[model samples]
Target: MSQAWLRQPERGSVGLLRFAAWLAHHAGRNATRLLLYPITVYYILTSPAGRGASRDYLARVLAEPPGWRQIFRHFFCFAQTILDRVLLLAGRTDGFELAVFDRDGLLERARRGQGCLLLGAHLGSFDMLRLLAVEQAGLKLKILMRPDHNQMITSLLAALNPAVAATLQPIAGPADMLRLRELLAAGYVVGLLADRATPEDRLVTVDFLGGQAALPATPIQLASRLGVPVFTCVGLYLGGRRYEAHFDLLAEQIVIPRSAAMDATRLWVERYAAQLARYLKLAPYNWFNFYLFWQA
Candidate 1:
């Protein structure tokens, strides 16, 4: 919930993304994947903030302090996810191994048209989860997103699939809130990224990666108001062509009485932070918040 990510400039341009998309489609994935090496190297060399963030995160997650090789791999893993996002969005999931670990039956509920709040962190390939929940499991999923955060990437991804773009409910004004309520009422799962807190958001600090980091309280707060089921989800990239989507129920219904609202919110946020940390260690390179994450 440090706003450092908001302060950082968008790294790649639309034209560059378009070219990458073009290459991905025309040349096969194996051929196009070769480009990620240079792209990863370019970012590692050019973006000092991103490099430092990688080092800091890896140092906490790994047994030993991270070196150039670990940093390069971290950036490369992120680049790989970005590349796969293009393919996944374009409906080109031919060779990739897509696995889902939904032991809690949340996905089955989604498949049955039961509405819930899917709260996730920026830990892995969200596009993969979207593919599994929407395309595969047939869940009516509406993602709450700020399109203006990374306009170029958003625009490019939208261009790939207009249908997916239509599912994006922009996080603006009261009208969007009304839209979310309507969707939930009609049995649609609302997807939200809960880790990053904007300036307007209320936050709760928790122990994360051996340090105290603030996370947004608003997602859980909104769930409490809406009185819906809430689940924590993530799609982990397990190297090579394998990706796994996990879904775990966080709450049957989030209820915070006014008298204990702060404590209630903190409890839920801490639970989410603990789950996120567990997932972070499972695939450390997949933590893609490319900024000083432990700072304000």
Candidate 2:
């Protein structure tokens, strides 16, 4: 479904998130498997169009499916979603461990009271990172998200997790840069997705997963403008209802190196792309780019 459909009154962001949490808490592994069986069968039989589209795109990107392995990969992805929702509902804070790479590097920068920007992908349970920031690091996190398409989901999340609702700040475009700047000025950690670029956004073309892809340049631009450090975080699901959140400092200071001349954008874009590929290779199924990404 398009994210726009999520805006339906009954499925507002808050409501949908709460429902997800409820399912996570109530559905055990076996129960969730049984419940998802019908949906799986239906998708397998009725989603030929979508499957074909995905197949075509994969072929163009030189990522063609290896027969049954690809099928199992997609199946595991569907199953992972069920498990992720359950974990979110269970709220078992200590059940998982965060394996932060180059953490001290980021921490050292954070201690300067200048704040930092966290650029992440939609690969894993992004929401879970909020808890780690607040509960583990004692840092206030502000998430920039697109406004929920569904009012019902939004309302439900507001009612069930007020803290999360309070921290979520939705922005539509670069006009919201002032707010982001203000947050950084106040030493608050700001996190945003950096893999998707819309028409109104600045695009940074990079080599990713053996192909050229475009990524949103807002995160890099904002960090450079604000003089804040940038970090890339990747969350990996390690099974048994656990996840490992990895954080790495991407840049100590996003200075346009003198030697790069007019190629500064390309330099930074490649850096980000290389790091992203590394993580995705570690958890291929976790890469959640559902739409055509490497083309157009």
Q: For model 2, what is the error of residue 16's alpha carbon versus the real structure, in angstroms, after optimal superposition?
A: 8.3
- Tens digits of per-residue lDDT for model 1 on 200-275? 7898887787888888889999999898899999999999989988888999898999999999899999888888
Tell me the lDDT of model 1 at 165.
82
Candidate 1 — worst ten consecutive residues by lDDT sum? Answer: 11-20
lDDT of 2 by residue, 1-296 (tens): 22212222331223324444665568745565555555554554554543543454344433555454464455456455545544553454544555544556656655666688888886666666666633367676788777734345445557656766677778876678889888888888888887766455577677777767777776676677778888887776655556667787888788765576337866786788788778666665566554456643
Cand. 2 Cα-lDDT: 0.62
Query: All candidates' lDDT scores?
Result: 0.84, 0.62
**Highest lDDT among the candidates is held by which one?**
1
Model 2 scores worst on lDDT over the 10 consecutive residues at 4-13
True-vs-predicted CA distance for residue 214, candidate 2, Å: 1.6
Candidate 1 local Cα displacement, residue 161, angstroms: 0.9
